[model samples]
Target chain A: AQTVTQSQPEMSVQEAETVTLSCTYDTSESDYYLFWYKQPPSRQMILVIRQEAYKQQNATENRFSVNFQKAAKSFSLKISDSQLGDAAMYFCAYGSGAGSYQLTFGKGTKLSVIP
Target chain B: SQTIHQWPATLVQPVGSPLSLECTVEGTSNPNLYWYRQAAGRGLQLLFYSVGIGQISSEVPQNLSASRPQDRQFILSSKKLLLSDSGFYLCAWSSQPNQPQHFGDGTRLSIL
Candidate 1:
């Protein structure tokens, strides 16, 4: 079984600043995928970004970028120019590449954006 | 575009009551459907997942059970609800592995 760990329980950042949420996973499979999901007060899980274990290049989406260190098994999300809309509970999830539909998720980190 | 629908938006059931929740996906075929229960501050706990109609996989042993009547319709039911079942229930779908899952608005279940 694969496990995802988000060491940070809560993180805060000032408006326009950058914030990074830490995530690490333990998996024996070399082929897998990592994901970051954002859940706002509405409780909808929104896909922030995804990283493939085989791909060395990190993934980025607008202000959201992931520093994926495959060797260290660390995949962290960096939110630049943070906005108020970014306030939510962030989760780190792991998925197998062997055509499995199950996704293991971390406890989650609560992000607060201060104006 | 593919979308997932889960309902009712909120449910209130008394302990030992029967419970049912439905989820459907549109604009996609042969999707992998999943049911998850989320507790406050904790992440999602996968309850059940299905690959095809009439094929359901149970992750945790509990009073809950899941069924797939159609290609895209997934149902979660309980013969006798327990107070521990009070939490947010979410339905999600993915075309296959290595794809990001899309989630519905989710149903909040409260057992009194």
Candidate 2:
């Protein structure tokens, strides 16, 4: 079974600053996908960024980026120029492959952006 | 663009009552649909998933059941609701198994 782990229960960052959320996973498959999802007070699950196991350049989406280290099974999310809107419960998720429909998610990390 | 819809934004039902939450997708065909439950301050718990019409897969053993009567419609149901079933029910869809899933606003179900 594939499992994702987010160690940071809570994180705080000042507006215009940067913050990083830690995430790790246990997967035997080499070809898989990793994702970072944000759930605000509205409770809407929004996709922040994604990374493919076969890609080594990492993935960046505007102010959000991922440091994906496949060998170490670590996929951390970095939020730059953090804004108040970035405050939310961030989750790390793992998917097996192109044919697997199961998405295993981590417990989650609550991010608080101080204005 | 594809969109997912889950309705009755908020629902309050009595214990032992029947439950039927509807979810539908538009602008996409043969998409993978999923049902998830989110408890307070907790992560998402995948309840069920479907690959196609009439193909439903259960991820957890619970009182809830799911059905895929149409390629774009998925339903979650329970013959008798339990208090523990009270949570935020979310419906999601993805173009493929490894793609990013788009989530619906969700249905806040409260069992009294």
Candidate 3:
């Protein structure tokens, strides 16, 4: 079974600053997908960004970018120009590229944005 | 565009009462559906998944049961509610097995 690990339980960043949340996974499959999901106080799960294992270049969405190091099995999310609305619980998930519907998730990291 | 909908954003039920939560997807066909539970201060626990109609797969043995009556309709039920079952239940769908899942707003179940 694949497992996702988010070492940081909690992270804080000042407004307009940059903060990175760390994530690592244990997977034997070479082809897989890594995702970052944000859950706000409303308890809605929102997709932040995603990275494909076969792709060497990282993925970015506006202020959100990922540092996907395939060799090290590390996929981290970097939030630049952080805003207060970014405060939420961030989760790291792993899924196989093959026909698997399961998404292994980490406990999650609580992010607090300071003004 | 495809969208997922889960009913009763919040629900409160008495102990031992029967429970049913409905979820439906629009503008999609034969999509993969899933049911997950998020307990207070914990990560998401996948309860059930279905690849097609009447093809439910249980990930954990619990008081919950899921059914896919139609291609885009998934339902989660329990014979009798348990206090331990109280949590945030979410319904999600993906066009394909490897695609990113789109989640509903989620139903907050409170068993008294």
Candidate 4:
């Protein structure tokens, strides 16, 4: 079984600043995928960024990027030039290559953007 | 241009009442479907997933049950509702096992 952990429960960042949310996971599978999802008050889950375990290079999507350390089992999300719209509950998820399409998610980190 | 739809947007039901939530995908075929429950201020909990029609996998033992009647239609049901079952129900789909999942708007379920 794979378990994801988000140590930071709450995080705040001033507008136009940068913020990093930490995430770690315990998984025995070598081939897997890591994802960051954002949920706003609308309750819609949106994919922020994703990183494959085999890829040594981190994944970046515009202002959102991931610092994936496979050896350390750590995958952290970094949001640059943060805006008020970035305020939401962020979740870290884990999935494997050969198995069910089910994803195990961390408790989540609530991000607050201050103007 | 694949898209997922789930409904009703909001639902309120009494305890012991039967429950059913429907999810459908468009512009895709033979996609993997999933059902997840998100408690308030918490992460998503995977309830069920299906790789194909009539192939449902349960991630957690709970009061919920899922069915895939068609290639693009997935349904979550319960014999009776419970207060613990109250949460936001999300439907997701992916083209492959390791691909990133696309999510629906989610259904807000309130069990009284």
DockQ, all candidates in order: 0.85, 0.86, 0.77, 0.83
Residues A1-115, model 2: lDDT tens digits: 8888999999999999999999999988989999999999998899999898998998999999999988899999999999999999999999898588888899999999999
Query: Model 4 residue B49 lDDT?
Result: 91
Model 2 ranges off by over 4 Å:
none
Tens digits of lDDT, candidate 2, B1-110: 88888998999999999999999999999999999999987889999999999999999998999999999999999999999999999999999889999999999999
Give per-residue CA lDDT, model 3, range A44-66, as digits (tens): 89888988888898999999999
Specify the poorest-scoring 10-residue window by lDDT in model 4 chain B.
B38-47
**Root-mean-square deviation of every model:** 0.7, 0.9, 0.9, 1.1
- Give the candidates in order of DockQ, highest first: 2, 1, 4, 3
Question: Which portions of model 1 show Cα errors greater than 4 Å?
Answer: none
lDDT values, one for every candidate: 0.95, 0.94, 0.94, 0.94
Clashing pairs in 4: none
lDDT of 2 at A38: 96
Clash pairs for candidate 2: none
- In candidate 3, stretches whose alpha carbon ends up further than 4 angstroms from where it belongs are none
TM-score of chain A of 3: 0.98
Model 1, global lDDT: 0.95
From the highest lDDT down, the ranking of the candidates is 1, 3, 2, 4
What is the TM-score of each predicted model, taking all chains together?
A: 0.98, 0.98, 0.98, 0.97
- Fraction of native contacts in model 1? 0.78
Per-residue alpha-carbon lDDT of candidate 1 for residues A1-115, written as tens digits (9 for 90 to 100): 8999999999999999999999999999999999999999999999999998899899999999999988899999999999999999999999998977889999999999999
